[model samples]
Target: MRKNLAGVRNRLLQVVALYAPGGDSTRVRLHRLRGVEIGEDTWIGFDTLIEPSYPHRVVIGRRVAVGMRVLILAHFAHHGRNRESSEGTMDDRVSVRIEDDAFIGPGVMIMPNVTIGAGAVVAAGSVVTRSVAPLTMVQGNPAKPIARCGIPLGLDTPIKEFYRRLTPIEPPAE
Candidate 1:
């Protein structure tokens, strides 16, 4: 009964957070009460969905910006084929941490066990499957590194510096 009541309360808070004003501190507070560890001055945009089942697994660092419609999932099914049946798929839970000063763009989906490094910028609509490096800019499905903003570690070229650098697709010359 206690667990069920907590779940209901958490759901209500989520609804309130969705409807609450963007600048309202109450919205942030509600999420905190729901067990999401959001740091000071972090801006969680409208419709942002943090892991509801494991809210405590999500840790948002100071000044991080989670854009509208962003989905941070702390749990996923190991087996994709049989999603409905509990026996078919095993549910795995892992913590997700958005480091300080990181920027998660709108509609982004961050999978479990991912850590958005400090000052990293995730482009809109990105699907992050793994951890991102600090001070890097990532985009596209699976979230490949596009550029580095801070001082390079030791790589010769720009592309070489990335953790998983992908060749940019160029447009056909007209």
Candidate 2:
């Protein structure tokens, strides 16, 4: 009982944090939600929206960074057999899972039934229609593989270490 209550409280807090006044401009709007998990230390930028039509349709992992103007949709409008009578309704619904440490760039669109693998980087302005491999970089309209992470180029350094090496140069004593 306590766990259930905690879960509800967490969900409510998330909704408030995301949709509250003066909070994030990017908000998650849904018709129905169930078992949707957003991990810790994730940053969702402005103008982003996530709408899940069905229950348990969206799951975002930890340390995931979503850029501005990103859209994550979990339902689509499908037309019936009769084209004339079918006006296309939101019937086909699927789940979308963004794994841990994933970086989704600005203006990116993630469709339903897609899993963004762990540590994957989706470039800015890309439309992702399929699953991305782990630790890979994908770009372009359809989001193709551009590069792989953990490649040996002597440039592999922890983010903290890289930042720690930076030094501010002082002006010459004038």
Spell out the clash pairs found in candidate 2.
none
Candidate 2, residues 1-174: lDDT per residue as tens digits?
995775576556445544444311223332123345567556676656665233356778777777877888776743442244243433322368888888888899998778998877788999999899877777888888877755211113466643344333343468
- Candidate 1, 72-126: lDDT as tens digits: 8887743552365544332323369888878888999999888989878898999
C-alpha RMSD by candidate, in order = 8.0, 12.1
lDDT of each: 0.77, 0.64
Candidate 1, residue 72: Cα displacement in angstroms equals 0.8
* For model 2, the run of ten residues with the poorest summed lDDT: 23-32
Off by over 4 Å in 2: 1-35, 78-94, 151-174
Best of the candidates, lDDT: 1
For candidate 1, the clash count comes to 0
Q: What is the lDDT of residue 136 in candidate 1?
A: 81
